[model samples]
Structure formats: structure tokens, C-alpha cells
Target: MTISTNSLMSLREYFSNQQILICFNGPISTNLIGEIGSALKEHIESNHAPELEVMDVFSVYIEMSQNIRNYATSHGFSDSESSATVVIAAAEAGHYAVCAGNLVEMGDGQALLERIHELAACDKAQLKLLYKQQLRQPHTQTPGQGAGLGLIEIARRSSQPMEASLDPLEPGRAFFSLRAII
Candidate 1:
């Protein structure tokens, strides 16, 4: 499906019976994450949905947002530059999906794809173990930015395997998109 960029700009798009799109931009700050998290929690609760589902959304949202924050710092993606956007939208499948796209060095795309492919193949049990292992590893963050544990946590929580793509932007930069459904 052709997902329009504008569809992700407003949370209203995700509020209906089948979907809700929660989108954010730029460098992620703690305050912004809290606000976004609260808004999503309130959105789910306002619908009178089960607390379980709301918690699911909350957990997934935190992971996705943190990914964006890390990407900004790791890849030098700035919010004002229009090179990064993070979106969390609920779908008809009864799952909430998180998607983040940002600019990165073209050289990193291949390695990122390889990492995503590895995570996608891992089962939940394996993902949980990986999350714990990665968490314990000293945060050897790369040059620009990254916390490094977000993906393992995402894989652990997502109902399905994580999905990602690297699209070319410029000669030296590419757009990386990652999605997970919970």
C-alpha cells in the first residue's frame, strides 16, 4: 500500500474504528516522549478499550520513540531538517504498528538490513534473551548516536517480526525505515 507521508502527520488518522496514526518528528526529547506516550494512552483509554491493549501500545510506543531518539543522535538526523519522522499507527489487524524513517549514511544501510533480517528470524524467546544480553553490554554507541538496545526490545514485544527498508536519498545518505507491530 502507498502510505502517504501526510497520513502520519496527525494522530486523528488513527482514532477511527480500524486505525490511529501517532506521528512525531525531529530530535526526540524525554518530554516529547512522555507527551506522546500520554496522548496515546489517553487515546486508547478514551476508546474504552481494554487496559491490556493500552499497555501493549504504551510499551511498543516507548521502544519506537527511543529508536528515533537514538537514530537522531547516531545518524545526526535533526528534526528541523525534514530527514526524520516517527509514526505509530493502529491498524485493522488489531495491532499497533510503529514506523520510523530517517536519514543515515548509505554505507550503514547494508549492515542495518542485515541486523534487521537477523532480528526478524528470531523467535520471542530468543529475542528476550538477546534483549537482556544487549542491555548488559556497555552502551558502545557509535560516533553520532544510538542507545543500541531498542531493536532487541522491539523484537521482544512485537507480535510479528520487525520490518525495515533502506531507501536511497542522496549519494552518501539513505532513508532507513523500521516498523514493528505489537
Candidate 2:
């Protein structure tokens, strides 16, 4: 496959319509995450975003990307399965949205989606309590297991409720996507 010029143009048009400022799709490494994260910070600063909002967006992006990287590494996924698609877009009312997606085992995706839904239902105070609770728990023994604080933090920082979806892919895998508006 060769992508024709028309197809490329169409993709660009779609991104523009969505107000996407940055997008990356592939296997993410620590170095790549850092590089992209720096770019994101610069973009936010240049746009004159508030300092607190800029920090929130940067932190959320790092947390989400690291989660994807760790999940893929711990699960022994192939490169294609480990690859992630991350996007930062401008939302209405001067808000920004960070979205991420990757293929995951169907079961794992469902569990994560459920957790996200639970977090989404919570009010800000509830999320704060949850975050504090998670922070107090000892880290899981497993190398890649999380205490779920990252999800709670994301929810607390978001201006709107977080959203997540799973799209069935192969028999045992699905594409899990999450969007957080800040």
C-alpha cells in the first residue's frame, strides 16, 4: 500500500475538522513519549493556555501513554497490538482533549472500561477521595500492575466526565479508546 495524494489530503482535512493539534500512531517507547510530551507542552505554552491547565494536560498525557506502554510490555503483545494512537485536539470553549487508543485483550479492555465508567460517575470530591485512597494503598506486587490512581487523577483533572469505548477487533482483542476533556 501506497496512499494516494487524495487520501492523504482527506486525512488532513479530517484532522483539521476535528481541530487536532497533534497525533501519533505506533509503538510508543519511553523516549518517544518524552519527546512527544515535550512537544505537547510547548504547544500548550505557545497557545497561551493557563499554567495549571497546561500542567494538567501534560500530566494526563504522560500517564495515559505510560499506561499503554506498560500494558503492552507486561502482556507480551506483538508490535501491532502494542501500538497506540494518541491525539490532542482543541475542543469548544477553549478546552483541550487528549485521546488515546490501542488494541487490548477483550477481557482486559472490558475491565478497564468498567473502571473508567465508575470513575466517570463520581463527582469531583468523590474522585479526590478515590485518588487519595488509591495513593495510600501499597503498590501491587506484580511489576506492571497499577493502583488505579492514574485513572482517578485523570478523572479529577478533567473538566468533563471521561469517556471510553471498546471496538471489537479480532476475536480475542478490541480497540480501547479513552477521551478526557480538560
Candidate 3:
């Protein structure tokens, strides 16, 4: 399909208004993760972002991207369903918004939303405590089979509570999006 010049310009305007530095929509793979992640790091560093902030933003991007990939692989999702949309944009107060969305089982999406809400309710101290508690528990060594530590790690790095949304796409399926402010 050919994209018209007007539509392309509109997208450019929209991205400019949003201060979006990077946007991707496609099937995510490990190699793709590294390539995009490298680009993100370079972009952030070029803007003279603080060293710590750059690391935090990059870390969150990797964790979210990996989570989407692993979940899709483990769940045996089709290529179309496994495709991911990731956006990283500049926010107020020198903060960065790292957001990712992918199709998920309806039940899984609802459960994830609930989990995010629970984490959002916790204060920094509580989150720290929970992170420690999670560490002491037995966890699988594999990617997707872990003890849910990745989300906690992302939460810890976030300057504010993470936000998530689940939009129904079809029966027994929904598009789940997660945003972490770092």
C-alpha cells in the first residue's frame, strides 16, 4: 500500500507535537530489540540526557520490549497477534515516557491491569520492600517463566506509578498497553 504525501506529513506533524523520539510497530525479535535499543540510547545521549536517566529509560524500554516478545512466544501467538507497537516520547520535567502495546489474551490483559493497579497503589518504600520479597522467592530462570521481577524492576526505575490500559480487540483477545514514566 502506498502512503500519500499528505498522510505522511500529518504523521510527522503529530509526532512533532507529541515530542516522540522513536515509534515502532512490527513483530519484535531479539535482534530487533538490540538494534532499536541502540538507536534509543544514541538518541537519548545526543540530547544530553543525564547519564542515570538515560540508563533508566533504556532499561525500561528493554524490559517492556522483552516482556512483550516473551509473552507472545510463550503463548504461541500468531505473527499478527505478536506484533508490538512501542513509543518513546519526551515528557515534562525532563522525564521520558516509554510505552508498549501488544495483543494479549483477554484474561491475561485483565490480570495484568489488576497487577499494575496494585503496584501503583504502593509507595516507594512499599515497592522496595516488595522487590526484596520477590527476590527471596524461588523464581524460574527462563525469560517469561520468571517470578515477575521484571515489572517490579521497571516500577522501581519509574519516577511515577506506571499506567496500563486494556482495549478489547476481539472475542477473547485485547490489546494491552503499558506506560512507564522515567
Candidate 4:
């Protein structure tokens, strides 16, 4: 098998057209998350993004990446199942879009997508209330189960409603993707 140069160039051109600043697709470890987070921070800063915006982007990226890592680990997924795709891109009017996806059990992905849709339908004040309510809830001891406050926090920080989808793969599994614009 031979790799086509034109195909590689087209891939690069696609990213450039989409204004994707950073993209990673593979198994993600804790250390890799930190490294990518650092690069993301530097990239945003160098672009003269406001301090708050930078923090929000970094925070959301960490939360999303960590959730994928923890979920994969808790479910005892193999490396292939554990692989994740993350992208940070420039959006309209100086906003940045942080998107991530990973493989998940079909049921789990559907449940998560439902929750995200609920959050997306909420107004800012409603989200703030939900955030506080989630904060007051007791934390779960399960590895992949937290108070679920991260989702609320991400919603609160987003300039627009968060978006999510679950694409069916083979039986019992799907690809779960989320997008948060800030």
C-alpha cells in the first residue's frame, strides 16, 4: 500500500479551510492530555485571545479529554476503543470551538446525548441553577461517575448551546461527539 501525497495535502487543506488550529486523533493518556492542553493554551494566547476565553477553552478541553480517558479506563476498553479525536478550531466572531469524540457503548452514548440536549435547551440562568444544584450533590465513588458538574460547567462557559451526537457503529457501540463553542 502506498500513501498518496495528494490525499495528505487534501487533508491539510481541509483543516486549513476549517480553521482548525489543533487536532489529535488517537489513544489519549493523561500526560498526552496535559501536553496538548499546554499547546492549546499557548496557541490561544499567541492569538491574543482574552484571558477568560483562554481559560474557558482550556478548562473545557481538559474536562472533555479527561471524561473520555476515565470512561475508557473504567470500561476496560482496549487501545482501539480508547482512542479519541479532539479538535480546536476558530469559529465566527473570535469564538473558539472545542470538539471531541470517542467510542462508547450505544446505550451510554444515547444517554449522554440526551443529557447534552437537555442542557443545550436551557437558558443561561437555568444552566447556572443546574450547575449549583449539581455542585451540591454528593459525588459518586465510581471512576467514571462524578457529580456530573463538569457538563453543567461546560454549558455555563459556552457562548452557545453545547452540541452532541451519537453515531451508530457496530452493535452495542457508537461514536459520541460533543462540541462546545466559546
Better of 3 and 4 by TM-score: 4
Clashing residue pairs in candidate 2 are none
Model 2 poorest ten-residue lDDT run: 138-147
* Candidate 2 displacement at residue 29 in angstroms: 0.7
lDDT of 2 by residue, 41-151 (tens): 999999898999999999999999999999899999888878999999999899999999988889889999999989989999999999888889888868567529888
Steric clash pairs (candidate 3):
none
TM-score of 3: 0.96
Tens digits of per-residue lDDT for model 1, 1-182: 66567875443444553354576667667678889889989987887878987887788778766665666665555665334577777764667777777677777766877888999999988888888888788776365444347667767778889899999877887888888787
**Best candidate according to TM-score:** 4
Per-residue CA lDDT of model 3 for 66-162, tens digit only, reads 9999999998988888899999999989899999999988988998899899998888899899999998987776645621778888889999999
Q: In candidate 1, residue 36 scores what lDDT?
A: 84
Per-residue C-alpha lDDT of model 4 across residues 1-182, encoded as one tens digit per residue: 66699988998999999999999999999999999999999999998988999999999999999999999999999998999999999999999999999999998898898899999999999999998888788777888773189988889999999999899999999999999999
* lDDT of the candidates, in the order given: 0.73, 0.92, 0.92, 0.93
Among these predictions, the greatest lDDT belongs to 4
Q: Which stretches of candidate 1 lie over 4 Å from their true place?
A: 1-18, 25-29, 74-79, 141-147
What are the TM-scores, per candidate, against the unseen true structure?
Answer: 0.76, 0.96, 0.96, 0.96
